[model samples]
Target: MTPRFAITDAEIATVVAEFYAVARTHPGLGPVFAAHVTDWPAHEAKITRFWKNAIQFDRSYDGNPLQVHRDATDVRAGMFDVWLGLFDSVLRRQLPPETAAAWSTLAHRIGRGLRFGLTPQNGGPPDLRGPAR
Candidate 1:
């Protein structure tokens, strides 16, 4: 899909609000977010800022996303997929087609990075690891 100029903060806020509403209730994600995020409003604003930085290169956000997810002991591998799924659904519902696709692509990539960073690396399975001991 073609890029539509740059997404605005208002659009960012809308996406954050609508997406988190779904996330805050998603079966795989609800408990994780509930456990980590106590203040919804503040969390929404932080997410908006994060997206603003991502979509607009505004550099208004300063939080460490990797560390934040790493710190969330409740974060799990499949949860990122759930997060991305909900984000894509909400963005598609609320925004233009190109805008939704672009943001969803970004979210999916970020989700992959988070999933990788968050999942524990206990060496690999026997098959994936070097010859068995």
Candidate 2:
């Protein structure tokens, strides 16, 4: 049977766009993302492609988030809470509950992975949870 939550490109774009609109200005995540990404439109498109590949299995994204976060001084384990919070809010607002659940699972997984990878002192495996309401 088909998946209960199947996301479309348009949905991905909408989520990414709306999410960044908040994240870019968020007190915690805004500076982190801004310090790293100089081009907003390009970054948004890249994020769109990244989520599309992740959620849709399109295999279109090529960038390395692990490396990027590792190199950035602003990325940290505690910051993921802020990032996931914003992402959860955007997903909850922009998509249906089932679809948001499916997408948030991936986002949480990515957040946990990035947090661990970026923190050299923390090598434990990541425990991914569904997005916050």
* Residue pairs in candidate 2 whose N, alpha carbon or C atoms collide under 3 angstroms: none
Please provide, for model 1 over 1-133, each residue's C-alpha lDDT reduced to its tens digit, 9 standing for 90 to 100: 3222467778889989998888877777788889999999999989888888766767789898878887887777777766777788888888899888878877776777677776678332222111233
Candidate 1: residue pairs that collide: none
Off by over 4 Å in 2: 1-4, 123-133
Weakest 10 consecutive residues, lDDT, candidate 1? 123-132
Which residues of candidate 1, in runs, are more than 4 Å off? 1-5, 122-133
Q: Which digits, one per residue and each the tens of the lDDT, describe model 2 over residues 36-68?
A: 889989999998988877766577798987787
Native-referenced Cα lDDT, model 1 = 0.76
Which 10 residues in a row give candidate 2 its minimum summed lDDT?
124-133
